[model samples]
Target: MTERTAKAARRARVLDDIDLRLLRALWMDGRARVRVLARDLALADSAVSVRLRRLREQGVLAGVHAEVDPAVLGLTTQALVMIRLSPNTDSRAYEERLRTMRSVLGAVALVGDFDLEVHLACRDMADLERSVTALRDAGAESTHTQLIARTVAGLGQALLTEEEPA
Candidate 1:
């Protein structure tokens, strides 16, 4: 789908107060039982279950996953690497190449100066260097990288609890 169509599809999901509460509770602890969430939200267990199912169906609530610490996995360094591709290059091909790299956690296509931004988790500086080299080999014309000093907040904190004006 086109970017505008994709945005419109995502915007179509309407989240109400109960959905917000359910998301908040899940963010705090993904594995929380429906009974506990219902108790916390003062709703019936069956109602909470149905709401959760609806959220999943609407793609508002993705799968619950374990949040693993990178340090424990020997990936102690994090970096944001912005890449500018050669003119007329197929960005989808470059993104698919990035997906094959184990160090790349995620990639985002950008609208401005940078063509893409990559989030990387590496064992050390050498690993990061290798990752950059791989990107260069994959057709990145230029790159700007910055080591992440710290994360102030994460995806959980950024989730919307209420709808904003369109």
Candidate 2:
């Protein structure tokens, strides 16, 4: 779908006050018990359950997943590696190859000088070198790596709870 059409489709999923609260609650703790959520929202357990189901059905609530720290897994270093794809490279296959690499935390397609931006978390310089080499093997024509000094903002905060203009 076109970007405009996709955005309009997303905007069609109107989030009311209850929906916002429920989403915020889930964002805080995806594994929170339904009873706890109901109590927090001052709603019945069944109501909370129904709302959650509806949210999932409407594509508002994606599946719950554990966000693991790279450090916890012995990945101490992090870098944002911007890559230019080689000519005739298969974008889908290249991305699939990136997914198989444990050190590649995330990869996103871009519209600027770089074709893809990769988030790499590795054990050390040697591990980072290996990952970059692997990326080149997977079809990166060239790369520019920037070590992350610190994250000014992390993902734990509630993003959707902000007061969006109507």
> How many backbone clashes does every candidate have?
0, 0
Model 2 root-mean-square deviation: 2.4
What TM-score would candidate 1 get against the native?
0.85
**Residue 95 CA displacement from its true place in model 1, Å:** 1.3
Alpha-carbon error at 157 in model 1, in Å? Answer: 3.2
lDDT of 1 by residue, 33-90 (tens): 9999999999999999999998888767779988777878999999999999988678
Q: Encode model 2's per-residue lDDT on 49-164: one tens digit a residue.
A: 99999888877787888888888889999999999999989988899898799998898999989999999999999999998898998898999999988777447444575555
Q: Which residue pairs does candidate 2 place in steric collision?
A: none
Candidate 2, 45: how far from true, in Å? 0.4
Report lDDT per candidate.
0.86, 0.87
Instruction: Report residue 155 deviation for candidate 2 (angstroms).
Output: 4.3
Full-model lDDT, candidate 1: 0.86
Reference-based TM-score of each model: 0.85, 0.89
Model 2 spans > 4 angstroms off: 1-13, 153-158
Q: What is the lDDT of residue 152 in candidate 1?
A: 74
